[model samples]
Target: MMQYRFPENFWWGSASSGPQSEGATLRDGKSATIWDKWFDESPNRFFNQVGPQDTSTFYDHFRSDIQLMKQLNHNTFRTSIAWARLIPNGTGEVNPLAVRFYNDMLDELLANGIEPFINLFHFDMPLCMQEKGGWESREVVDAYADFAETCFRLFGGKVKFWFTFNEPIVPVEGGYLYDFHYPNVVDFRRAATVAYHTMLAHAKAVQRYRALQQEGQIGIVLNLTPSYPRSQHPSDLQASKIADLFFNRSFLDPAVKGEYPAELVELLKQYDQLPHCEAGDAELLAQGKVDLLGVNYYQPRRVKARANAVNPASPFMPEWFFDYYEMPGRKMNPHRGWEIYEKGIYDILINLRDNYGNIPSYISENGMGVEGEEKFLVEGQIQDDYRIKFVSDHLQWLHKGISENCACKGYHLWTFIDNWSWSNAYKNRYGFVQLDLATQKRTIKKSGEWFADVSRNNGF
Candidate 1:
């Protein structure tokens, strides 16, 4: 086998979020977020009733976790600053405890020779801001801008890489369209509004970051699922294109090119789903072009033209023009039930290279989640050979992309440790270090050991 070497100084780490890892949900002056509220209202919605408060307790054990990261030879790590924790009221006096915690955490990471890539939001919207109509209201957008600016002003010096949001589309799909998230509203128009406002917020954050003259780079983390047509037919090709427009280009265009795709705009207009945009919005988005992009690839989207007639009375949706096509013989991740498509990573990079000016990017989040992962535990440590293989497969394609001058700079897995996930909670574990939730013990898995060597060598 050929040695899969990466570029010099290639970043190797993992991505986590405040809402998922930090267990002190309401402690240290943190206000309620949508996660806290939803879990309070319906604990049954979460796996085994495990709420946000029952996470890995990073807030309490960050020192040990940082040590674990050092042991793993991580060069960089990505996590978010909880808006609810930073500003309890959404816009008021900054919480001193939150500031102290983040400052100490960032300094500790720096002292450990690890670079901290900080994100401003990660779907843990402050409940107060959500009450103000979430992303639909321009007021919440302004508040988010303020929160982002606060993050840059407070920690911009220590953190050189900043992201405006992580998977910003998840909220639109989970909250507005799919009913998997809080404020579960199944309305396409509302989903469009949320999506549009999120990009606007992202642009505003970038604008503010540049205005402050921060010596740092700011970008947005998007989970880009490359859309693949089921057949060579024109209808199938058109269907895949539409799906790509709705899910990928909707955010990618504005964040990179500083404008929305013309086809997306026309499609939304045709469906009467055009989001309400304020004056000067175009210029604002134009200013939102990022210096970096974080790409999270796990699966590819297979689609084909809709085979059945549409009901005029039904609410409009992206699917009105396309239908999901599950390709036969596709590789699968049995536990997560998601397609295992390693080549999709290369496809995304190639697309960026050929179409989007080859933006400087990194694989910010990619990992396999296994339900009942404890079944693989052996001799007090998880023999996660499956995970090791999963990562190696993806990195093989990532190396191919980089060799072809894709401009992809690094690779970060989905997580470093087993932590609480939204709704699913800890039902599926995606981590290199397994956390004994019962005793707060951390054990490095086989993959973690393997990754340490890969990071040290900058290859496998």
Candidate 2:
């Protein structure tokens, strides 16, 4: 049998977001987030009319949940601090109750020997800030900076790992282009502006964190979909490279290297879609490079050159330059419909090693989401052998990368327990511990037990 030992002191944990897991949306002076407001306005947008108000009830069950972390042999865990919960209005006075809740939660996790990795934003923008244009307006950017500063000063002692945003592009895609998230608008220029301003906000947060001289490592979590060409043909290769530039490098470059890809800049300029930039914005980005990076890999993008040219009269979009090509014979996750390409993880780590100065990084989020997971329940425990295989395969590749001197540090699964996923709600379950929503109960699945062994033994 092959050994699967990981590096010493590797972080064994899971990743979660406040909006997706924490309930009590209205308790203790918590105000409305964009998700809360959107659900109220259009309940139909979310799956089964479920909203963000009542999730896994983590707000009330955090202590018990930390105990669950200990049961799973987790030494480190990642969860976001809902911006709306802390600064309900997106500015002005901080909520004392919110501060108390987070402090207590942090203390509980630390008390149980689980290192807490806290993220600042996870797409739950305060409703008041959205009314002021959210990421598009500079006013909201300043407000977010103030919010980051407050968090560092308030809870910087207990928390050692901080992330500015989680999958920032998802908002630009969902809200601005795809119309899945709130304030849905399909304007390419608006999407570009939102993307740019989000980077600015992240930079501002990093600047504030550094200014405080916080002991923790601050970073950003990005879902990087490596683009693969359908064939080695020049057109197809160019298409794939362009897709990578847009989806991956757009954020990766700025967050790590304190710069943007020039090719992307030229492409935007060619389309007359470059976002409006301000003085000192470049300086701010340069000064705010992260100390660590969290990579969330789930799928790969296969692209080919557009068969037909897009009409110049139509509004610009990222897909206007390339087309998605579904490769036949590609292995797929039958439950989630995502292509199963484990090599993408190794490729990303290698790219970071060769191009990004070998920055410290980790597998922030990777998992398989199975729909109707209750059917797998065997004697009241989910027999998630498929999840186990999925994780094991990915870990094999991650281990290879570490052997090659990649600065990869840890592996955090997509989540700790089955929690609410934005509009999808509970349609697709991706957790080692199965959650019984009806009883608010958490049960460790077969995969969870296996993972506990993996963590305890430092390998399989």
Candidate 3:
């Protein structure tokens, strides 16, 4: 195998979230979130009929969890603060217990020599706020900015990096388009509105962080899947371009360049679906280019021209141009059915290098998730060679990008332990540490041991 060394001070760690890990939801005076609402309304949508209680009990085992981080040779850890945990109502009273809990978690991570990267939101919107239109309403954006400001004021000195949102499009498409979340709707116009407001909330949060005078970096995380057409036919090329515009540039151009692509804007306008914008939105976004970028590359999108003719009088649809193509021979994660293309990471990095100004960036969430992962059992441990291969292959491309002077600094896998995945529940496990749902016990996998060596050596 080839070898490449990472830069000095490069981050190596695992990422997790509070909603997925903190099971004592009601215990900490934390109110319900959109996830809670969804589960309440329909429990059958979740895999294995699991719910939040199946969350990886990190709220109880965080001290041990941080210890596990040290054993894994990690120098950084990415985690989220549950907004409802801090402000059960999304405004006014602050939960002192929630504050103490987070303070202790941060202290433990730092005490173990792991730098803490905190993100403010990760799709767990407070149910109270969601009832008021969620991100679709300008009021929710203001509330979010307030929430960001409060977190900074409380934890700015201790937190070195803060992120405003994580995988912003997931909510728009999953909830609004695919009916996978609370208040599920399949209207494309509403999806467009949700996307616009989410970006606005991001800008407003950035603006607030600037006002608070924190001496740390803040950014948004986009799950960017580089789009590739199935072939060079003209229609295929056009279809691929539209997919990229919607999935990539919708957030990339605004968050990075502070403006939307002209074609995207025109397309939205022609459909009378452009979001309601404030007078200063342009200036706010322009002045709000992030201090850093978090790239979450899981797979590349393979597209082909539509298989059928278009209706000349029908309303605008992103699908009128392109359809997804399931290419043959691409590696597959049989556990959860997502294509595995390691070079996709390199393509994303190179695009950033040439087109996106080579912004300071790093992989925030990339990992292999497996279903019924425990069955691959060894002598009291899971022998996850597939997971190890996943990281190694992705790192090979990452090493390539770094060798060519791409601005990427580090690699953080999708998770630290098997935690609750929104609709999937505990079905797809992506973790170095395995969480026994019955007892909430933490155990290291064979790959976890291998990762410790990877971190200690700084290369492979």
- For model 1, the stretches where C-alpha displacement exceeds 4 angstroms are none
Error at 128, model 3, angstroms: 0.4
| Clash count, predicted structure 2 | 0
Provide the global lDDT of candidate 3 against the true structure. 0.88
Name the runs in model 3 displaced over 4 angstroms: 310-316
For residues 285-378, what per-residue lDDT tens digits would candidate 2 score against the true structure?
9977999999999988999999998988877788887999999999998988999999899999999999999999999999999999899999
Per-model TM-score versus the true fold: 0.99, 0.99, 0.97
Better of 1 and 3 by lDDT: 1
What lDDT would each prediction earn against the true structure? 0.94, 0.92, 0.88
For model 1, residues 287-310, the per-residue Cα lDDT tens digits are: 999999999988899999899999
- For all predictions, the C-alpha RMSD in Å is 0.9, 0.9, 1.5
Worst 10 residues of 1 by lDDT: 1-10
Candidate 2: RMSD to truth: 0.9
Pairs with backbone N, CA or C atoms under 3 Å apart (clashes), candidate 3? none
